[model samples]
Target: MDADHLLTRRTVLATATAGVAAGAFPQTSVARRLRREPFARAGTFASGVASGQPNQRGITLWTRLHDIGASERLGMEIARDPGFARVVHRETIRAAAVRDFTARTRVLTRRLDPGERYFYRFFTRTTQSPVGAFKTLRPPDSREPVRIGWFSCQRYEHGFFTPHAGLAAEEDLDLVVSLGDYLYEEDSPAKLAEREQSTGDPNGHVETLEQWRAKHRLYRSDASLQAMHAAHPVIAIWDDCEVEGNWAGEGPSSGPSPVGPRSVPFSVKQRNGFLTFFENMPQEPIGSERFRIYRRLRLGGLVDLFLLDTRKYRDPQPCEDATFEGDVPPCLDADRPGRKRVGPAQQRWLTAGLERAQATWKVLGNAQMMMALDIAPTRPVGYDSWDGYGAERRAILEQVRASGVENLVSIVGDVHTFFAGELHTTGRIGSPVVGTEFVGTSVSHDGIEVVGDEQQSALVTDRIVLSNPHLRYAKFGVRGYSVLEARPDELRVDFKGVRSVLAPTSETYLLKSFRVAAGTPRVRPA
Candidate 1:
């Protein structure tokens, strides 16, 4: 946190408590009385509508009112056609400040047939939002091809969200998977200026409930991110940035020299991060908790999507809490019997799910990469990734091989680099290979562009290939997302790249692609 932006702990708590009151959308009585003025003067529905947590029986609908009066009751109208000729589902949703003036309602669609397209919009008094259309997932055991687009790591200040805009316009995807780093919590003059943010006061790293809510609002204000949500059903999982960078269980975020790897206990920030995350996302209450984003999605039994939560419940990094650039001798604590990336309970659950899965393809939606970056024996690699937890990685790969579980692929984000390769049990390239891994580049983060230790493209490619035999593709310099097209027999991934995120009007094209066949642990150009 910037010294200038730091707030007293008492002030932070009081501000959050005072701002949130049931039915009172505004904290100030005067604003509460004048809330209707903003709502009436302009359209109340500014963030638009989105649908997620899609299952065979129902889907969750979400919307945020740019302005709301005291004790306002919003109307939700759903239909099969865009013109609203036939309204199928109608309900009243309460828009209160307790939920940050957002409505997340789940509608059970057993009344309607499955796989039908539906148009939905929200109503406030006399205003009506634009209708959003979404297609339902196909029936069970249908063997229908599933088109999924997964993206992550969009720093609001680094560049435009044009990739999201392009994905919304061009990709006909069944599910939009956001693998985390949805928003950066820190804001600097350089970044703020680039994003055209006019914060007269010095903005610091976010650390409170109010700050979290404000950050969510600012990100949703972007048209590209809003359009992407409105266009498809998004299945999302958070990485470190949502709360803090490289944050493990009950840990602080990683930052520069001042903000050390293990800086402070951010229990408050973590809770607030999750609170705003649920308030913004369309997930229903899983179990009795407001948080907990790790859940599985079934796509007609053709694919079983296991969304894992890597940041929440886990031991700290094994190598003395190091950053992405930090490395040292392996620590004994890494394999201290119970150290885990997904933890013990999640590991058991995932193991059981994979063993009993009946789907043709089992897909793991992960936050960090699985590839063991084979550095020299004298050099230490990044401690914030699976490379830090070598034992856990070996266990999962061994589980996959032991179960004879064919057709497994892990789609990951974070690290802001692209990697298409085979998963080896040990860090050595000669180790036994198990499954396939495709790590997508960041949407707006800085791209490594330079492969290997050298700038020469040919030498870098040759070095990467020779150093890690399991890796078939490697590129660090690019800003884009990945497309995963899954069939019964094979899974194809396209690493789509944009020329520059700094350019608002940049176009997206395929940079590279690879295919992994069923029962084979190899990556080849499609």
Candidate 2:
């Protein structure tokens, strides 16, 4: 039978098994069917499904069974059409407790044809998941433009994922690029806003492997997140929050570093957590010789995307080496020996990628602000962003100018606000107007947490704009996602802000729009 028929039959069985009078049976029926027949369900397994890592050949499929030892294999199917009347290919995945019962099957099917839509579903003996649809990346020679929605940072307790639901309803986007903060490390009640409410274990810190996997499961439980997973493939990269907040490669910890090796907490467990993250995400880990965390994808020559990992190869934050803990030091001060930092390896990778890019528009899927801005300078230290990494930031901007890469746009998250600016270097070494950038606001992060009065966010945005001639726009108070569209002649970016994130029914409004031409490095109001 087809996938829908399979689910219908299973649901009927679930209802019957539960018995109409006993509501417990319906939920139990699903769990029972999943464990007894197909796989041995153990932990909290109803985390849902996601598909990503698309190519002309095939795409990646992901799901996790909660039980530590599922001790069973899963069957997955993909079709050229949704009905599955004509199945293209199928496979069985042997999942185990060692990997958190997570399974991934890189299916090779002829069903991936240009300009065609396809449907996919994962199945076991008694249970079949809802269907997901994906399309192949159009060949570089094709003339039609492909559209995409990009976003980042969703703290579950702060608000509902209403914006994600809106994105799922959008009829046009071919994919979504998530630039990290997929899950937060601190799940404590105190860390979250007092007004916010979460059902389970608020502020339950996730320092172990199991906690991380469970957190990913918790996020997947949101209906809006599940719906988005079923709609389109996603290109993603993790930032600080995915791991420990502001964690670096090396650290002194709470006190001074020991002269000898000290026991690091759950290093293996944290690595496993990263693996679980990979298992659940749609994108496959790019396994190259150097094990680089960078990948490039093209959409019919209309757009080229470079997604990078800024967290992995970076120098530990300067404060990591400090002996004191009352307060962290400022990263912007040139004199501060301990400042926020980025390593050399990542800098080299990004510069090389920009030099090699060949597309109508080159987009950088980054995690935090690349443009320098002084936020709250009066206090003592100046900043924490690219301003702190002055040397590295200049080098990257110089490469963009020297490589002659036109129409560059960097989409970033973190800092929970919307920002638009141009890369400005001190000298004539770089392009006068190096490129354009659009920083998407958070999905449901700390809402309106600007410093001082609500006016502070605007004041900071205005001063940065006035100080830098190349910088174009900045809005901090709103929260939501961004729609990035490009044609051969012009590219448009729209910042869609939700009216409120605290509720399930938040409304989206177009807060701003900016465009850049194929030859122009600067963006202008459209």
Candidate 3:
């Protein structure tokens, strides 16, 4: 990467976290206390609501109070019954200016029965917001089937977020797992046909902490995202674009075309983005800055979903040449300096997590692809993905083999395409493929735009599937979400796609479906 680009990225983010500490906002005036509710309606400014990180015992409720200058004190009422006539737990929390007046509270009430539906909504002033319904995870001791919606790569400007709306109303899922790219920091300018008006912060590019928070606010303001939050809890993690495109820790922004550094080649500023992210998003069991996002959530005994942090601790992506410029040229050498690769610590953590997992289904919530790809292997290639780091990818597969974890399924995003495949330890393993992976296409971002002709695109997809025997399906042009249903004896996945995201309300369609037996790792046609 160029030195100027690296310096520019850092300079833009400096002091962005100012006035962000706890209790940083000034006290409210007496006159405001007596004022009527602001943003009382859910659809008006708050846009939507969401619940996440659910355990059998409790769940976290989230809503942002969208107002200028003043902060709003939001209240939530969770009830077993839909009517507020019988309230289970009522929480009145302060949504201060520091966190964009977003109220994230944990409502611990025994009344929220496991696997049973419950209604919740925010209250400000005398007005009540729209009521949203969600369910709690079954107890750890209970072993029952669970259904979840897994998706990633939701870019705001590329298209509409109709997928979220579809998932919100079209399915009865316990939760939605978002692997990454919840918000894109920099958009693909050439690909955007229309631009969304800037909300509170400046538009162009989001580099500073304020810009990132504002981007999150912009996304949360969407009705579809809020509705999904209202219906079911969301399990989310960040991809490179969430902070920066292909950013690996604190490193040079761009460099040698595909094989560069084996690990982080720059500073600690990259890690700071994760800190800012946790501030806006609701997460649990806060810990040290080093390896925080690599945690596991168990849905009773039916499933154990491991949300991985692929960008945080990984090494800088490598390029094919020492002094390449812009995107790598096709038909160039693959043995260049800047190939993408992961560090040892993250690899070890993933191996241990997979090895120790005892759930019937071990689903990895990964941000990028785990399977090897032949994307310009014979020429100059981009190493920001798994293709950049052969050794690291090999070690990861080896660990999976040694661990012998059954029903290992990986749900991924980032490429803006739908990909289904099996993960093999190596070219010589008995099964060749040890686990199955389903990559969700982008929610709204530009998808397969570079591939124009339908016949040509279909041929490319076919070649990718044909060359990689483990790859069963590939849809490069679809845009949508995924619904994963896990039964005692089988696991089924349905890929739902939206027609076009350029408009607000788009029609949805079923793109494809796949399933795996209780103990099998390969996904068969459902």
Number of the top TM-score candidate? 1
Per-candidate TM-score against the hidden true structure = 0.85, 0.81, 0.81
Q: What would the per-residue lDDT of candidate 2 be over residues 1-526, giving only the tens digit for each residue?
A: 8776775455334433332334333476654554443432223336666777777767888776554444565656677777776767665554556666777777666656865667887665456677888777777777677788888888887777778887877776767989888877565343335324332233345655666777777778777778887888887887767766655543322224221231236355347547767767866667663334468887777778888776665555443333112355553443243333446656676678778767788888888777655433322122234544456666677777888877788888876777777766531224466777788888888743435775776675675555544457777667788888888898888888888876777777889998878887676888
Query: Judged by lDDT against the true structure, how good is candidate 3?
Result: 0.67
25-71 per-residue lDDT for model 3 (tens digits): 45567434523334322323364667788877688877666654665
Over 45-114, each residue of candidate 1 has an lDDT whose tens digit, in order, gives: 7777788887775778898877665445566767788766677776656565777888788888675556
The number of the candidate with the highest lDDT is 1
RMSD of each: 9.3, 7.8, 10.7
Rate residue 512 of model 1 by lDDT: 91
Judge candidate 2 at residue 510 and give its lDDT: 83
The weakest ten consecutive residues by lDDT in model 2 span 375-384
State which candidate, 1 or 2, has the greater TM-score: 1
Relative to the true structure, candidate 3 reaches a TM of 0.81
